[model samples]
Target chain A: MDSSLGGILSPRAIRDDGASMRLTRTIGLAATLMLIAVGLVFLRAEQTRLAKATLALESEWVHLRGERWALQAQVARLRTPAQTRGRMAIFGVALDPPRPASPRTPLSRLALVP
Target chain B: MNTRVDVTQRRNGTVVLVGIALLLVALAGRIVHINWTLHEKLTGIADRQQSGSTIIPHRRGLIFDARGRMVAGSRLVPDVFVDPLLVGDVDALAQDLGARLNLDPGKLADGIRARAGRRFHVVARGVDEVTAKAVREMRNPAVGLTMRSARTYPLGASMAHVLGFVGRDGVGLEGIESWHNEHLSGRDGRRRTIRDAARRALHGVEGGAVRPVDGGHIVLTIDAEIQAAAERAVENAVAQFEAESGVAVVMSPKTGEVLAMVSWPTYDPNRFGESTPQQRRNRVVTDPTEPGSTFKPFLASGALADGVLSTTELIDCGMGRRYFGRRLVKDVSPHGLMDIKGIITKSSNIGMGIIAERMGDAALYDIMRRFGFGERLGIECPGEASGIVYPLRRWTSMSAASIAMGYEVAVTPIQLAAAFSAIVNDGVYVAPRLVKRLLTSDGTVLEQRNSRPPPRRVIPSDVARYMATELLVSVVANGSGWRAALDDYQVMGKTGTAKLPFADRKGYEPGAYLSLFMGAAPARDPQVVAVVMIRRPNPSIGYYGGQVSGPAVREILRETLAYLGVPPDGTVAMTAAYRSRPGL
Candidate 1:
């Protein structure tokens, strides 16, 4: 009889044990939800940072393309015949002007006296 | 009394609990309805706020001369515009823009005022790098800069007629530009991107981009060196003689490739708006003229081919003048009796008239048609004229004689050049070609799906060779075209001086003349055929084709032959058999 009494539990004690278990479960669920929310926010921030960097790089690429075309145009202009002739004149190798077929005839036979 | 109060308290607590439960139920139902019924709509709104599309600019093709020199290219330049409605302190804005763009501040302000309500206005177009940088540094929200691709011609006015020009809307308007616009203009690309709150593209979407296709490159058959020489010679000749205008065409007699074509009074295609339509005209292919004595060689060849006359056949030329069917046919000078060779050397009209009378109208017309006259040669240019060839049905009583004298027929300079090319190209008529090949942007030649037609035979090979080597050579060696003889090479050619007809078709212009010279060099094995035509030289200076146009042809040929490194042959002497004796 004593052993039986020793093994028996009170309703108040059982009620207290159940309440503690429920409290523990509720706290674990809340912690897991908080962690998931923090993970989502961090991922969003990283995506935005990467997008901004890519935008800057793309802008630079476009600018470089424009620069390339401008440089090509400049090089072509420098290689033109007129520019080459000008450079030749800068040195001592200028081309001679064409000589007329006949000696330039006198524009007037005689000048008028003042 | 206690029991009654307890019951009332229980009733009030029950009522409050019921109200709380009902409100919770309504909130849960509303959440379900939004998640299920409006899901797609809400997602679309979010995507609209985050993503957008942008166009990637395309690059037009490049044009290179045969020497691989870039004659035309495309460049990116900033085109600045203003939003007048967004402008603040208009006077300050104008002053800032004027200082950078070299515009009058007052005028700019007035322009802005005139467009106050408008959202957009052009501030400047195609600004250079320095000016564009200054405007960008201003950082004004009211101003905007659009990067546009513009065409650039490195050779400028030197190749204006061949390279043509592009319009403000990126459309080809003239010359090779218009002819090959489809191959030269590439397709623009589109990219789907995620945008920021300010409507700027942040990053591209995955698999959402359509890449641009760049235009193909064009290689022309024009030799820049030869082209420059021809232009210089023609320009100098026109200026020397004080002529109205001039034309020069240099072509490869072996391949019918036009090396250089220059039309005097040319305009700078870069500033085409400042020039007149007359200056922009490509007269080499578009203008027609009576060939005069130049037509005599063709007549003689046709008569020889028809078996009506032989090179050694003799006929009497009466006192420098004769009457054929009431048509008075006169020569520049009288000749007694001569064969076909002497008649060509002396350029006798009476001799040509007698030969044409024997051939009759049908035979003569057939010969002219076979020579590519009175028809478009199908050259790769715009507005090629089919020149007048009055058909056999339209012939009057005097048509045969007049046609033989080169009076009734009109031919373009290119047509005449091609006809002469046929004679020099060993009897084959090869159409003239300008473009050599097309290349992809990456430098791979495209397959030739549209090759030129094969050369066809028009005259016998032996007959064509004899005319170019024997008869035409004599004309330059001792005949009227002696002025066209070059010092290093043996030149074979003919001369023509024809009266210009009035525009109204009433009669010939008073004292107006067209002087022309057509020739080929290294007579035995010809290389290049050059034709020079001078329009309306001062009659006082010289109106004869031999005097005015011959020297220009000589200069062009001299430069071209020297550049080509053709070895000089000793002077060509007339053979004793073909030389005109005092009394043949």
Candidate 2:
């Protein structure tokens, strides 16, 4: 008689009830889909943030590049002959015509000596 | 009580159904109206707002001299614009900006006021960064700044004719700038971006964008220092002589590289518009002048080559005057009997007439054609004049005599220089070249130098040597070009003083002479071939090529040769610069 009662109240038979089993299966799937949706939302937010950051950086890069070129042009302008002649006043001496090397102690002779 | 409760429930259900139906009808009506009636207007608005693309202009090429000095380049500058809708205190703002930008305050104010009812106004097209920075500091809501690139010529008008200038639309207008405009102007880029209500680019939303490719750089054969030296000499000579114009060319005879070319009454390329069209013209490549006595050597070379004349053959100059084909041919100075060599040395017009008479027209024409005269010579620069060369059939009885004495033909200064360079280059002609190479922005060489044109063989080397040694060498040593002599350097050159023709092209203009000095240094193995020409100078200052242009050539050549450090040849005391060199 006890064996018969144990068989009737077994864990497998209680799990076989269709109404409760269906409810648990449906809940598990809904929870899984909800988690996946939550993950995707976070991923999209991160991607947008990165894209916006890259755009801002690119714009800044263009601005800085233009600035660098302008500075280079200015530097080149200052190095010109006209500018050099105009700015020679700080040295308190005028630029004279360039003189040639001394023939008495010639560079060719010096190079040949050693 | 149950019946009354059922009735209340039924009434509430009916009211709820009615409310739901009304909401559905209104939503459907709105959808139909928008799709059918308002499509075109909304689409147009959307296009104006979102479809427009912004251009990213490509930077124009940079021009570098032989020594890698930037002569012409582009720089990014701020262009000032205004939104009249957002403007405040236009006059006050104009005054504030005028002081910094060097603009007329009244003009700015007037323009700003005139722009009323307009949303946008170009206050200033291109402005320096410093002025733009000041404007930004003011933080005026009305003012807006856009970046634009402008061509900058740091050396100003030093090589303006070659470097050329950019138009307001950033296209090359003349010189190498125009010839290589395709390579100099790189492809512009573009991008699509979302703009806000204020039509400002949204940096957050980056979309389709094409990055600009900066233009290639051009490397010229011109040496900046040598160019400056040549220009200075020409400038001084022009001013001192009070001449209408002057041009000087310094070239490497072996390579046909034009190291320096200068024309007087020059204007700064920085302010190219202020220059007259005449000043803007590169006369070395454009204007052709009759070569006068310089034609003597080429004719001599031709005669000697054809065995029509020998080195020591004596010809009577008839006391500096002779009748050749009913024309009274006279020399600037009197001469008696002159050999082929003495003819060039004394620049005897009568002597040349005799040589030309013997050589005839066809052979002379063929030799001149080989010498690269009366032809373009096909240089890298633009606007080259071919000069006037009559056909063999067109030669008159007097044509040969006139041609021999450097008349009845016109030749550009560069053509004359290159032709003389041929004589210096061992009787071979090489076309004059300006640019050495073209380089990409990243320094990749896009185009190497132009291949040398086929070598033109004009005269035999032995004849060329005799002309260089016996004839041209004497011109500087003891002849008309004596003023161009250096104590320790053998100079081979000719002096030419030709009469300018009248506007009517009828007869020559009196008292208007074009004085020219062309020569090569260390004549034994020539290096630099230089030419100096002064046009329509005041006769009082001096009009003779020997006096006006020779001394100038000597000084220029002395400086250039010193800079070159080429060892001297002649047995004489050297200049300080040459003497100072390490070895004697």
Candidate 3:
């Protein structure tokens, strides 16, 4: 009685049962692999972003340093003794002579009763 | 049988599960190590990438005169910079900046294009405060203003020789500034900053910092008021005489400190580049000339000190000419028979020749060396020449006679002045000095330069006193230096009119002579010794040292005496004694 019942079973039902089990095993493996690949891609994108940021900062540093050098040179030129004297002359400044008595006797003592 | 089989399977499953758990734990340990290592590397890279802020320069130190008046110093000026990348309307910006800053449009354009993408380039430098304010008000985003110190000289053209000028690079080119460059320049400071990708300064980052050390200040011994007076006197004399060049030096006889040293045809330190080499020279120290009759005093002192001649001893000048071998030494005029005092008073060439023969060349050369002739005064100023005074061994028969009359010997004005000062200061020869002292920023005397030795006695004090008395008589009675005589003071001095030797000319060009007057006032005890020399005065008025360079000494003395407040020696009789001498 067992052999006659088995022989009467449909081919579609047998194929469906084998196919569903194989699909389940394949789907489980694919899902696990997909999760690992997604994690790696996210990490790679973050690293690339950080590298660009660092490069940008270096460029800015270079620019700032250049500015500082130029400014410093200009300041040095203007503060030189020759140029300063020229500017003062344009402004009409004069030097006062030394008061021979300043260092010797005080001016008060040198003054006469007249 | 079923129970035994089920128990065996369960044991195997448990062993497999334990193996998987251990592998997973090992993988987690590796990942954790990698993350820690990566974090460290990333942090280091980020730190290296951080930007720093621009450095700002500090002001330089100030240079003041002896009176604490600002002479060479720095003043704040505006500097303009542009970020070419941010600049708009390039032509308009160029025109505006060029107009305001006095920059050429073409130069401005080239500057902007030179560093097109650069964050900052100097658009204009050293703009006045008012102009800088105007630029700031323009409110251009591309333009930036920086306040910087520019060196300024308040006294223009007056003390140019001593003060010196700075180059475009802010370094001293000549004079005192050049000599003390390191002490007069400041150390620059720096600042650091962190910036983002857009070059915006980031806060909370370690700001790098360095403070600037300002340059040391200098205080000169020159008196500006006297300097002006001296300059004016020299200029007026130079113009009036139509002289090629001239020099005047006012010095303190006791200290050997130079108060005012003026050389005519001088250029302003501010416009040094535009001046000729002749104008740039400090003739007082650099140029050597035949001192003419001025050399007679030193010779006379040597003769007196060596006991070769007495002040009262007489020498004969036969009709202005004396034969030395085949050479004829001619006096400017026939001085007739004269004593040592009379010889100097008349500046008689034949009279000096007689004294030279008695003293001999060796004794005279030794005395000249002791008086700092033929040597650099060792002053701080550069380019001082060692004047030419030949040794007695090199002297020919003619050389002795010529040197006696102030020829065959060349001396700088400084050396001449120093020697005269020594003679009048009781035979004590003091080395001349320009710098008085060096001071710190807080007015502390860092160093005092008064370590010079007491003057060496070159002549007897009594001899020097007698010579001073005689010199006073010369000025008051008949010497060419009479113009240098003071109103209420006894002035003693000599006059020199040496014919300039030309490479290609005949009969000395009639009027080409170095007119010189070397003198001291308050003859009883001299305080100031002044030397004035005028070169190549036009022959229109019988050019002589007495006629050309004399009045300058008078002007200087009058002003200097009033300024010094030295009471006049009312004893004018000393001058009368020389006037009563026989055969004047």
Among these predicted structures, which one has the highest TM-score?
A: 2
Q: What Cα-based lDDT does every candidate model obtain?
A: 0.83, 0.81, 0.75
Chain A TM-score by candidate, in order = 0.57, 0.64, 0.56
The RMSD of every model to the true structure, in order and in angstroms, is: 9.7, 7.2, 13.7
Give me the runs in candidate 2 sitting further than 4 Å from their true place. Answer: A1-49, A83-114, B1-23, B32-55, B83-121, B137-143, B197-200, B204-206, B571-584
Over the stretch B1-584, how does candidate 2's per-residue lDDT look in tens digits? 99999999988888888888888888888888777888788886675554435556678888898889888887776788776655678888888878867889899888888987765677787776678888888766567787666788878889888777888888898888888887888866776655555555553334578888888899999887778888888888888989999999999988888989888878887788888999989998899989999888888999999999887778988777788878889887777787886788889888999899899888989988898888887777778899888898888899999998899988999989988888877888878889899999888998878626766678898888778766787788768998999865778899999989997778989899999999888776788999999999899989999989998888778878877776676525323333344322
- For model 1, which pairs clash? none
The TM-score, computed over Cα atoms with residue i paired to residue i, of candidate 2 is 0.84
Winner by lDDT: 1
Real interface contacts reproduced by model 3, as a fraction = 0.00
Candidate 3 has an interface RMSD (Å) of 10.9
- Measured with C-alpha atoms, the lDDT of residue B169 in candidate 1 is 83
Per-prediction TM-score: 0.83, 0.84, 0.74
Misplaced by over 4 Å in model 3 are: A1-114, B1-56, B84-96, B116-120, B138-141, B193-207, B451-454, B503-510, B577-584
Per-residue accuracy of model 3 over B43-91 as CA lDDT, tens digit each: 6666645553555555565666566666676655567887787677788
Per-candidate DockQ versus the true complex?
Answer: 0.17, 0.25, 0.02
Arrange candidates by TM-score, highest first: which order?
Answer: 2, 1, 3
